[model samples]
Target: CVGGSNGGVKIEVVDQGIGIPQDDLPRIFEEFVQLEEADQRGTGLGLPISRRLAKLLGGTLEAESLPGVGSTFCLSLPAAHPTG
Candidate 1:
């Protein structure tokens, strides 16, 4: 994780598995949406729920991917300051 300009922190989750397709990237965070190759049993609610939780915490979650290469999911949140 790295510090953001606004006194927040950015955490990145990177994966080297098959990357997401450009066409499907936009909907990846939607509820009940899953990639064609994803496990058939998956409910596809994880990402959407995660994004909602991030927003509730005054943070943001985003993703970047390259087909056949890899993907990265980033979560940025406000940093906590220690009290004296």
Candidate 2:
């Protein structure tokens, strides 16, 4: 209302875990992407799929990280206006 534009909903996820490596940053949004040598097990399509769905809904999915510090992921979605 202030800017004559709708403000979207914001979603943020942060982890104090080991964080991410510099190299894997690029492919994090790609399908079948994972931190190589990661001792875990999974298809690694989660983020890619999430990003796709967000895009379809006029939203955005993104992430940020600091090697040994932590990481944060955010999702923004258009708000649904109420109908009288």
Which 10 consecutive positions of candidate 1 have the poorest summed lDDT? 1-10
Cα lDDT tens digits, model 2, 1-84, are: 111137777788899988888777768898887686767767989999999998898888888889889998988888766799
Give the best candidate by lDDT.
Answer: 1
How do the residues 1-84 of candidate 1 rate in per-residue lDDT, one tens digit apiece? 333557788889999988988889989899998777644568889999999998898788899999888999999888767899
- Global lDDT of model 1: 0.86
- Considering every candidate listed, which one attains the maximal TM-score? 1
Task: Show where candidate 2 strays beyond 4 Å.
Answer: 1-5, 81-84
List clashing residue pairs in candidate 1.
none
Error of 2 at 3 (Å): 13
Question: Per-residue error at 25 for model 1, in Å?
Answer: 0.5
